[model samples]
Target: MKFGIIGTGTVGTAIAVRLVEAGYQCLGVETRSARSYARFRQYLNRDRMPLESWVPEADLIFITTQDGMIGSAAKNLADRKLYKDGQIWIHCSGSQKAQILKEDPALPVKTLSMHPIQTFADVGEALKLLPGSHFGLEGEAVEEGIQIVWDLGGIPHRLDPEGKPLYHAGSVMASNYIVALADMAVQLFNLAGIPKEAALESLIPLMQGTLRNLEKVGLPQALTGPIARGDSEVVRSHLECIPLELQQAYRALGRSTLELAQAKMKLNGKEYPRQDLQILNYLLDGGKEKNNHGNCRENIRSKRNYC
Candidate 1:
């Protein structure tokens, strides 16, 4: 299949290079800025051309622009009557739906939104991580367009257009939120006088082990540590040691961990000795607190066999 890439950012260049390497013809790339055009040329080893020139030459076009620019770019292309009938136009924006491309009725393209569920810090690393990642696809042409995902060694999952924002939010929680949590961990380690690099190096093994446990055992079954053990003293100590700036985050995560532990049958009906429960209550009672006792008991009974 012949491919034309618009925007020429990291995602666009990475997909373009992968397509070329897989023996698909990459017709050309288009970008609005000189710097982006230069970067695209350097990464794809192809010259930048006008959108009008490139859009009509390929059977498929990828509009891998920033989320805000995608609609405008699509309109611009449609105004020029750039798309040929039967051509497929796909965007890599996780939060956008295929309907964005249908803004102009003059464009007879088969529109689809195909978002790779992986971070692309740069084109080089993105190319290496492309294979085996998930791609969320939405549009009428989904089945036909999914072949390109498979050709690129990716798994394609169908998503409802209405749920695009929610799907993208979940991805952000999984990918971006993890990074923020890691930063919090690093900050705690720094407070303990460990160098940033040393802290990260020390935590790598624990993080890997946790991920392995998740992969092997999954969710509540993989949960461990103080919360899982219902060790109120350790939990109290954690709350006491957390700085003011991080206290809220610690409490939020603790509540989540407590719920997970309860779901896993790790927390018994009797609160951790009164002193421990007192400390937990002090930490978690302030904001929208819910009665966890009944829910905890129900979860324990339901998953008793797992314990």
Candidate 2:
């Protein structure tokens, strides 16, 4: 099948290069910027053709522009009446639904969203990461999109249009939030007098090991450290020592982690003693009280169910 790409960014260039390598003919690319077009041509050795000439001729058209411009790009061709009856129109945005291509229910062409769930820093990275990546697919041409993903050596996951936001949220937490958590760890290490560079070097291996544990043992089982062991004293120490700015975030994460600890204990046919569980929950919940030793005390004075 012949394919034309309407954007000349990293994704578009990488897709064109891979598709040509997969024996798909190129109907040429379309882009407004001369610099982008030059880069696209450099990668694929294909001429930049006008929209009027390529849209009707190509079997597949990829609108690989940034998220905000996808609708405009599709509208441009739709207004020009350039789309053919059986052609496939696709976008690579993770969060946008394919229906943005055309709102008309009777539109003859098949519109689809085929988002590769991987990060790309450049064209080379995109080409390297695109294969074996999971793609979230939706819209009218899902079966055809699945075949296209197979051609690109990608895994395909069918998604409901209504679920696109949540799907993309999970991807963001997995990819982007990891970076944020690493930064937070580094900041705490710096506060402890560790150099930023040294802290990062030490933290990287620990993070990698945690990821390996997750892959090997799977969730709930992979959870570790003080909370997993129901060590309320350690958690109380953390709350007292950490900066006030970070306490809320730590407590929020701890609350969620405590639930995982409960699950892990249940899976092992063991559970935290009721007093221990209540103390851990109270510490994570930011309850403040003084015991006889002038230290933070658990909410044992109240008859409330911390569970």
Candidate 3:
């Protein structure tokens, strides 16, 4: 199929290169900035004509522009009557639904969003990573457009249009938050006199092992360490060791761990030892003076059913 890429950013370039390599005809690319146009020229076939003259020739168009620029770009293309009937327009933004292209109501075009669940530091790296990635697709014309993802060696999963934000949030948690959490780990390692590079290297094995465990056992069952074991003393020590600025993050993760532990049957419904429970309650309660009058012992008593 002939494809046109509307933005020459990292993702757009990567997608263009992939399509070209896969023997799909890449008609041309369009970008508003002169600098971006220069960048696109580098990767594109020098003999090919400019995008303004090529868009009308494409059977499929990829609106791979920045999230904020997608609607305007689509409208501009529609204004020029660039797309023909039965043409397909796909965007790569996870947070955006296909409705963004509704600005061109007269066009008999199929619009869809296909967001790959992978990070692209650059075009070259993205090209190497695109294969086998899961793509979240949503639109009125999803089935027909999904062939593009499949051609790129990606798995396509349909998502509800209204659930796009939540789906995107989940991806952010998995990809972006993991990076933030890694930074936090590196900071903690610095306290132990390990240099940033060394700390990052040291954590690689642990990260790989944790990933393996998740793959093998999944979620709460894969959970380990103090929270899973209901070792309130270790939990308390962790709280004490964390810096004041990071205490809230620690507490929040700890509470989440507790919830997971309970769900996994690691912790009984009854609370543990009174002293341990007191420490946990104190840490979880944000230093509030809330009463801990419930059955702490009963929480631990429920653990017998877990095994």
- Per model, state how many residue pairs clash: 0, 0, 9
Worst 10 residues of 1 by lDDT: 298-307
Candidate of highest lDDT: 2
**Order of candidate numbers by lDDT, starting with the best:** 2, 1, 3
lDDT of 1 at 178: 83
lDDT of each: 0.80, 0.87, 0.78
Looking at model 1, residue 67 earns an lDDT score of 89
Identify the superior model by lDDT, candidate 2 or candidate 3.
Answer: 2
Candidate 2 Cα lDDT to native: 0.87
Q: Distance from true position, residue 185, model 1, in Å? A: 1.4
Off by over 4 Å in 1: 266-282, 287-307
lDDT of 3 by residue, 178-272 (tens): 88888898876766568899999998889889999999989878888877766766665554455567678778887887778767763335545
Q: For every model shown, what is its TM-score relative to the native structure?
A: 0.84, 0.92, 0.85
Q: Is candidate 1 or candidate 3 better by lDDT?
A: 1
**What are the per-residue Cα lDDT tens digits for candidate 1 across 1-307?**
8988888788888888888888899888777878877877786777777777777878998888898999988888888888888998889889889889879655578998989999988888988999998999998689976898998889999999899889999999888998888889998777666878999988888988999999999988899898777676565555545566787888888888877876776333533455555556665644333332324323333533111
User: Which 10 consecutive positions of candidate 3 have the poorest summed lDDT?
Assistant: 298-307
User: Number of clashing pairs, model 3?
Assistant: 9
